[model samples]
Target: MEKLQVLDITGLSFTSLPLSIELLENLKSLCLDQCRLEDVTIIGKLKGLQFLSFLDSTIARLPKEIGGLTELRFLDLTGCTELKVIEPGMLGNLVNLEELYMENSFDQWEAEDKVPRSNASLAELKNMKNLSTLSIAIPHSVNLLRDLPFGKLNMHKIQIGEVWDCLCMHKESRTLELKLDSSYLLLEEWVQKCLQRAQDLHLGGLQDGNDSIHDLCIEDAEAEDGDEIDDDPKVKSCKLRRLTLRNLPMITSFYKRADYPVDLFDAQQLVFLVTSIIMNSVGYSPFAVNEATSLEAITIERCQLIRKVFDLEGLTTNEEVEILSRLRELTLSDLSSLEYIWNKNPQRASCFQNLRTLKVQNCENLRFLFSSSMAKALKQIKEIEIVSCDKMEEIINVQEEELEEAKSADTLNFPILTFLSLEELPNLRTFSYEKYDIHYPSLTRLTISSCPKMMTFSSSERKQQLMRADIGLQQAFGHINSGLSLPVFFNEKVLFPRLEELKLSSMCRLKRIWHNQLPEESFCKLTSFTVELCENLSHVFPSNSMDRLQSLNKIEVVGCPSLEALFEWVCLSSEKRQTPLVLSALKKIKLWNLPRLRDVLKSDRKVNFKSPCLMEVDVRCCHSLPYLFSSATARSLRKLAILEVSVAITYGA
Candidate 1:
C-alpha cells in the first residue's frame, strides 16, 4: 500500500474521504472520475500526488488547502459542469502543473480588478510557467486578462466566448472555438496570436457594428493591418487543418468575391471546412478559391443562398494547381438554392483524383453533378450517393458539340467504385447522355430507386462526339439522319465485371435495364438481382449474355406487369452448339404481383432450364402466369426444397 502509485475511484458518491484513504503517501496519480463529493481538503496530505483528475465529477469547489501539493504535474476537471469555484491562491500555488484541463467547468472567474478575491481567477495561471497543455472554456470574457500570454502553451484548446459541442480535436496543437460579441472580433493581440497558430478553428456568432458580419481579415492569419484589410485578399501561408463557420446569416457568396480577385480561403492548408450562407444577398460566393493540397473533406449543409460550390468560370489564369489533391470526402445537403456543383467552366488545371466519397442529398435545384470533363479525372472515386434532387436530369451533363469533340476515345472509368445509390430522383433521365465509354469495372453494390423517368444507361455514341463540326454542319444542311436515337441503358460492352448486387425499384418508365446484347464477360459475377415496380420491363437479361448468369444466386421480380418471361430466349434452341440455360448456382427465386408473367422458363425441346442448385421458389399474385417452367425444366430443379404458391395460381403454379 505504501508503494501505491495510482488509485482510481470511479462512479461513486461520497461526502468526504476516509482517514485510511490518505495512508497512501506514495500515490502519484489519483482519479476520482464521475464522483460526487462536497468537502475533502484531505487530498493535500498526499505530497507525492503528481496527477489528479476529477473528470465529469460533481465537485462544487476545490479547497484552497490542497494547493499545497506543489508536485502536481497534471490536473483534469473536464466536463465537471457543477464545479463553480476554485478557491483563491489554489491554482497559483501549483507551479509545476504541465497540463491543466478545465473545459466546461467553473466560469465565474474573479476579475483582476476585484477588491477581494472570492474564487480563483485567470491571474492564477500566470505562475504555471511549466504548463504546456491547456483546454478551457470561458463563457464570460468581460473580466479576462488583456495580457494573458496563451502563446506560451505548446498545445491548447481554448474557447473564449460562446460554447458549442466540443467535437473538434485539439491535434496536440493550438485550436480555438471563438464566438464573442461584435466588439471582440477585432484582432486583439492575444486573439490574433491564437488565430495564427490554430490548426482547427470554429467561429460563430460574429457580427460587425452594422450587423453585416463581413470580416475577411480573419482569413489573413498573417495580416498586421489592424482593421485595414485591403480588397485584394492577402495570400497568407496558413497551416489551418479545419475551419467551421456557423450562424453567419449575412455573407452569401461561396469562394468568390464577385468583382474582386479575392483569394480569401486559398490557404492551401485547410483540411476540413463548414460554411454558412444567409438572409438575402441574391448572389454570393467564397470568391477566388485557390487550389489547396491539404484539404481532406468539405461538408456544406443548410446554406439557403448557395447556388454553386466551385465556380471557376471566366478564370484566365496561366498557372496550374491541382484541386484539393488530398480531399477524400465531400458532402452537400439541404441547400435549397443549389443549382450547380461545378459551374460552366471546370478548372482546367484541377482534378478530383483523390476524392473517394461524394454524398449529395435534398438539394432540389441541382441539375447535374459533374460534366464529362470533370468526371474523367475521378479515377480514385469509390462511393457515390445522391438522393431527392428533383431537378437532377443526369449525373453527368453532356457538353455541346464543341467540347465533346475531342473526348471520343477517353474512358470515364471509376476503377475502384464499389457502391452507388440513387434514390427518389423523380426527373432523372440517365447517368450520362453522351461521348465516352463509362466503366465501372469494380462495382459491387448498386441501388436505383424511384427514378421514374430513367430509361437508358447512356445514349451518346462516342463516334458522334468525334464528328467534325464541318461534317455536322454539312449533315445539318443536308437534313440527313445520321441514324441517332435515344438508346437504352447499359450498351453493348463489358461493364461491371465484378458486380455482386443490383436492385431497381419504382422505375415506371424503365422498359429495359439494357437493350443491346452485351458481351459474355459483362455482369458475369452478378450474384443477386432484384427488380420491383418496374411495370414496363419485359425481361431481365439480354439473350447473348444469358448463359453468363452462372454466378447468379438469387432473383426477385415483383410488380412487373409487363414481364412475360424472367429470362430472354426462353424458347428452346435447336442447335447442339448452343449453351444450355443454366442457373447452376441459383439458390432462390421470388415472383410476386406479376399479373402478366407467362413463364419463368419455356423449353420446347432439349435446351431446357438447368438450375441444379435452385432451392427455394415463391410465386404469388401472378394470376396470368401460365406455368412456372416446362416439365423438362421443372424436373431439373432437383434441389428445390421450398415452393410457395398463392391461391391465385392456376393449377398450383
Candidate 2:
C-alpha cells in the first residue's frame, strides 16, 4: 500500500511527520479538529488524498495550487467561523466532486453585499450529474434559491426545512420545506407547491388575526362553499400516509373551503392522523366522513368543544355511520365541556365494537360515556382505563337484582378482557356489578387504587342486620357469604386460572378478600401479588385454610401496621411434618412497614427439611423482625436483603 493520504492537518503540536503513517495512500477523509499544530504547510505533497476538512481562520487560506487533488468528493469548513472571501475559480478543477458542507459563522454579522460571491465556477456543478446532496450555511442572508442558475435536479430525499427563512426566496422547488416563525408572513397566493412525490407536509409557527403578519394560513385561503375548490394549487394526494398539525395558534380550521382545500373523506387511502387544536375555539370542524374508510388510528387532544361530536340526523343513522370501520385505536383528552359524546348510541347497532383499547384522562365534565346500551355492545374490547377524571364518578351502575340474575345465568361473555384499571377518582363511591358485569376469566392484570369508597359488599352491620331481618336470618348469611367470595366461581370451578398479577392499594376498610368460602385453586397460577394500605386488614389470608395457594411464586406484604404478628405466627406453627406449611414454589418474598412483633425463617432446633424453595428475602422498615433465616438448614436461599431493621442473624452451615 502506498502512503496513506492526509488531505489537511493543522493546529496540532507535532513539528515533524510520523514516518510510519506514510504507507496508506488511499485515505480519502481527514480532519485535524481544534488541535495545537504550527507551521504545517507540507500538505501539498500528499497527492492521492481527495477529501479535505480544514478550519478557515485557524489555518491560513488555501494555496492557489489546492486544486491538485482531482478526486475530491467532500470538504467541511464548519468551525472556522471568521473565514470569508474565497478567490474566484478556487475549486474549478475538482471534476470528481460530489458534496461540499460549510458552516457559515459570519452570516450573523456580515452584510448581504459584503459576503463572497460563489467563487467556484458554475460549469463544475452542472456537468456533475452524480451529485446528489448539498448542504451549506450561507455567510450572509439572501434569497438564495429563487434565481438559482442550475436546471432541474432529481433526488429521493431533501431536508432543507430548518434553515432560517430569510436565507431562501420563495420558489417552486423540488421536495423541499419552507419554515416560518409565528410573526413571519409568506404571501399565500405566492406559495410555491413542490414535488410531485412529496408525501410528508408540516407547517410550524403560523399565527392568526389580521394585523399579526401571518396572512398565509389555511383558513385565509379563498373558499367558495364548504367544499374545497379543486382548481386551487394544493397537493392532491400523492403517497402521503402521516400528517401532523401541531402548535398552530392561527385562524382556526384545518381546510379553507374556498382555496387549497380538499376533503379527507375524499381521500380514500389515508391511514394515520394526529392533530392538536389547543388554541382553536372554532364552532365546527368536520375532520372525517365516510370517505376516509381506511383510517385506523386518530388522536384528538385539548380541543375544548361543544358537547356533542357526531350527530345522527339526515346523513346516516348511528347504525349506518361506519366512518372508521378499520379503526383500531382512538384517544380523547382535555375536552372539559365534552360531557355527552355519544348521543346516538341508543339508535346505533354498535359503536367502537372493533376497538381493542381505550384510554380516557382529565375529562372532568364527561358525565356519561356511551349510554349503558352501547357499552354492552362492545365485544372486541380487551382493555379499559380511566384516570384523573374528577367528575366521572361512576361509569357503570345497575340494580343489585340484575347482577344476581346474571351471575345465576352463568354467562361466558367478556371473551377478550385481560386488563382493567380504575384510579384517582375521589368522588367514586359505588361500583355496581350488574352494569359492568362481564365474565373476564382471561384477566391477568387488575389494579384498583386511590378510590376511597368502592364497596361492592356493604360494610354496615346495622344495614346487614336490617337486610337479614327483611330476608329472614337464614338466607342473609348465605347471601352475604356468597356475595363476598373471591377467585370467581365458574360452574363451581375457579375462574382466574391464568391470573398472574394482582394489586390493591388505598383500601382502608377492605378487611377481607373473602368472608367465608374459598376456591378449590386459590392463586393457582398467581406469580406476583401486592397489597398495600389496607389498615383494617388483620390477616393476609383466610384464617385457617391456605390449601389452594400452591403456585405463589412471589409475595409482597406492605404498609399494614396491624398485621405485624403474622410472621411470628408462621414461625410458631405446628412443626409436624405431615401438616407442615410448605411454600415450595415460592422463590421471592418482601415485607415492608409492618412495625409490630415479627420473627421469620427461624428454627429453635435443627431442622431436617427446610422451607426448600425460598431463595430471596427483602425486609424494609420492619422494626420487629429481629432474625431471619436463623436455621442451620439453609437449602435454596442464595441472596437476602435487609434495610432499616434492628436485627442480625447468623446462618449456620
Clashes (candidate 1): 13
If scored against the real structure, what TM-score would every candidate get? 0.78, 0.51
lDDT of each: 0.70, 0.45
Could you tell me the lDDT of residue 312 within candidate 2? 26
Give residue 60's lDDT in candidate 2 (0 to 100). 34
Residue-level lDDT of model 2, residues 1-653, one tens digit each, is 45445545556645544654434467665666654433333444444666767544354344434465567776555555544434334455555666654443222222224446434433334444445434344322233334232222322223333443322232212223334443332432223222222233333344343222222223333432232322323322222222222233332343223332222211111123211110122211233223333334444345443343433222223233443344555555665555644533324333556767766777777654444444565567788787767766455433233345444333334467778787876555433222233355677787777764443321222233433343443343332123332221122222455568877777553445543353444446777777787554445654333345567778787886655444222223344523555556777777777665254433343333334667667677776655555454354344333223333222231
| Candidate 2 lowest-lDDT run of ten | 270-279
485 in model 2: Cα distance from truth in Å? 13
RMSD of 2: 11.4
Q: What TM-score should be assigned to candidate 2?
A: 0.51
Best by TM-score: 1
The per-residue C-alpha lDDT of model 1 at residue 497 equals 83
